[model samples]
Target: MSSSDRLLLILHIGFAIFTLGPLTAATMATPRFIRNQNLVVVRYLNRTTRIYGIGTLGIFLFGLFLASGDFAKPWLSASMTLFIVALVLLLIVERDQRKAAHLLETAAAKAAPAASSTKTGGEGAEEGEKAEKAKAAKPAAPGADIAQVERGRIAAMSGVVALLWLVVLVLMVWNG
Candidate 1:
């Protein structure tokens, strides 16, 4: 391959690793954090998702540049299609994650009053203990079930996206 081709290939691979690596990590971690009801971790993962989502554009652009002369190749076409599919699926997963996070945040806000009231000296010690136990036993939120279901969906979609990425990688390495 020529120098320019080598450079483009390097850039394409670099962007792919830089963009997809964190994306996969964040995507996988999101559901786990959601299950734990750890909003802090969930929010951090969401931010990583957003940042990597934008970085994915570079992967596509560099890939196109590398494949500019090989557009007619069947493997290239298939890889491109898979890449698009994965991107769309990832976007859906990201949206659901954000929605789940919001639902959790709202639920926490709703429960905060009970927690604060329990902390105040106005409440008897026994009452405060009961309140704390009740709060712990209470469901995540009014929509906590819905959020859990959504997280499950996101996890499934993200798995498919990860599979598509692997397929695209295989195609590029073996057939491109």
Candidate 2:
């Protein structure tokens, strides 16, 4: 591999790990927590998408350089295909989460004025705000309703990616 190719591969691997790390971390959270409109999942997924998408794109670009020379093998092709698939899956999952997050935030914002206005504009205001926050703090209901469906798919996506990278590791070591 050329210096650029090797550099791209290293960068891509770093991106892959960063991309998948949120997935693993969010999965460790409860399903309701993962799907909640709290923005935690949204931020995590968005970051995951940006890093993984940009990183793998760089890899794909560099793959052109690699393929022009000594690295254009069948295994490399398969690995590339797998990598593309993984990126697509990650994007899909993150998109859904983003949609859900935006929707929920909007709803909460809408409810906020009404909720706050209801207070008597004194200690009641403080109490009402506290209550509203408490309401928000509680995890949103869990289901595959929106993002949950994509969240469910995350494991399969992660598993396939793990398998893909396993093949990559094997080929890299064995010169396949």
> How does each model score on TM-score?
0.87, 0.63
Q: Clash totals for all models, in order?
A: 0, 0
Model 2 residue 1 lDDT score: 63
Question: Which candidate number maximizes TM-score?
Answer: 1
lDDT of 2 by residue, 1-176 (tens): 67876787677556546644554444334234445555565666556555555655665565555466655587777667776776676566556556656655666676668766766776787787787787667643432244556456654655565566566657655763
Candidate 1 lDDT over 1-176, as tens digits, reads 99998998889899998889999989987887887777888888988998998899888888998887778988999999999988888888889888988988987887788677766465487788777887677554554564777789888998898899999999988986
Instruction: Give all candidates' CA lDDT scores.
Output: 0.85, 0.59
TM-score of 1: 0.87
What's the residue-level lDDT of 93 in candidate 2? 53
Off by over 4 Å in 1: 119-123, 126-146
TM-score between candidate 2 and the true structure: 0.63
C-alpha lDDT (0 to 100) for residue 26 of candidate 2: 46
